[model samples]
Target: MRPALHAEEDVLLVVDPQPTFMALCPDELPVPGAEAVIPVINRILAGPIARAVVTQDWHHPRHLSFASQHPGKRPLETVDLPYGTQVLWPDHGVRATPGAAIHPALDQAKVVMILRKGFRQAIDSYSGFRENDRQTGTGLAEWLRAVGARRLFIAGITRPYCVDWTAEDAAAARFETWVVEDACARLGPDDALDASRARLEAQGIRFTTADTLHGENA
Candidate 1:
């Protein structure tokens, strides 16, 4: 049986639903079908989800994670950073740019907070609760806990990266975590997404679709 979400205990987490990340954009890191998730997420917000939080990947121009900043490093090429292995990306989500802005299609009015990350120009932030260094905290956990948001319904773009990291952290933070599967898109192959799903399941993070959310009688 599927679990019921109580708005008092559960808050929707919309991750990186930006135009720059959509396949239609073609310039920034485009996750195929990313744009399609917005309406599903909006439907959830307008119905079962009364409270929400949104994340934006607000990067800086020439950010260290960008391949252009590192000579001879191509996008998606792996390299060692001071913190850990890093994935190089094309310049994206530059601060003050449209790519950095949340997609206007999203139901932003329902969101209680907007968390902007990856602005430091050195560290990358995929997890909404923590930076890539995994040491620096973003205070998302604290805010959620303080507000009594006990379960998290995470949705939005690039399921294998930002959404994946946020779900892992939410589980670690002891929130009953659920990933809205259809409300997410991916940048990589099916096997990569499969691997990420397996790991998240191992950590006890459950997955559901946006359809399930709206179909519920509750």
Candidate 2:
């Protein structure tokens, strides 16, 4: 018998797992066991999960999110923007760049939708629903609402940034949100991870693991 699904009212939201985002950075601490999470996501995608959605960071060559655009600036440096503080990324991940392409593990046939964000040069998008500042739009919220999704199960790369941001927003949107801890990785500081988790929890977002998605505890 299949183990109990950890959640019944959840839609899996896979954040940026593109090749560009997964390459190890020089200054950031590697996300603990993030590599192992890929297969887990694939398994969940193919499993009986209620639904699965993925996001791709599709940036223009001159995207403002890139440190390269702001010469002399470095990655992780926060700059004030119309939305708030924006984190400048070094010459690391560039979506659709051969290296930043989507992970092959995703079975597109199984995904209900693929939301592409960060296409604007001035706007840096992290969440699948809304851009930073909660003002910019992506139509993901409408899509989820149309699909009748009341809960979100989030996973994928860079736990502290993209995944964290998505989960926090989902909760703020009043959607039951959970971050599959084992299904994501982070390159931010340890403190950043803790802070991210704390903030999300404060918003009532649940933190879980892939084991919760499988049999019995599923």
Candidate 3:
């Protein structure tokens, strides 16, 4: 028998599934497994999860966050911005681009809300709730609170970056958070996934599977 479903206050958060992120080099550090997670994400959305939210990494072409825009650094190189440590990225998706939009995995009509972040040219946003600095806001927390989302199951592109950040921040914000382990994939070696999971578990994020989450009601 499947495990019982959590209460209705829980939610499923799908982090950046944008085109640029999805097309990332499979051998890159964070491992963009956008396609791999689709089926798992779809099942969760198709299940009894009370709320579903997604975050998009929308950016501008000349966005200051890009390492190429800086001229002196390479992507993945860290630089100190006024906000703090920022990961310089290769130019990704623009808000207007269809690739940056949410994948067709979930029924759009079923999601309660879609939260987008990283519009600013100067900052990099890895977490759905906040940017890397932890000061600048995405306003996701307020929105989640308004919707009464206390439990979060997170999955999406680049397991080591945005997905990891979102789950950590959600747990830190006092939400009961879980990362669907098998639903996600990574670009780095096994070490990266292990380390990321360790940090999340330390912060109180539970490690789970979409199968279990979806079959809980079976």
Q: What's the CA RMSD for each of the models?
A: 1.2, 3.4, 2.8
On the 0 to 100 scale, the lDDT of residue 193 in model 2 is: 88
On residues 1-218, what C-alpha lDDT tens digit does candidate 1 reach at each position? 36676767889999988888976568888876789899999888777667899989998887999999988889999788899999999888888888778998887877999999888889999999999999999999999999889999899877899999999999999999999998888778889999999999999999998878776644
Candidate numbers sorted by TM-score from highest down: 1, 3, 2
Q: After superposition, how far is residue 181 of candidate 1 from its true place, in Å?
A: 0.4
Which residues of candidate 1, in runs, are more than 4 Å off?
none
**Sequence-dependent TM-score of model 1:** 0.96
Candidate 2 structure quality by residue, lDDT tens digits, 1-218:
13344334558899876666543433322345555667888877766676788888888878787777776788778778888889887554455566556667666655778888888778888787788767887988778888788878899977788888888788778888889887888765889889879988888888877766654334
How high is each candidate's TM-score?
Answer: 0.96, 0.86, 0.89
Write one digit per residue (lDDT tens) for candidate 3, span 167-195.
88888788888888776656567898789
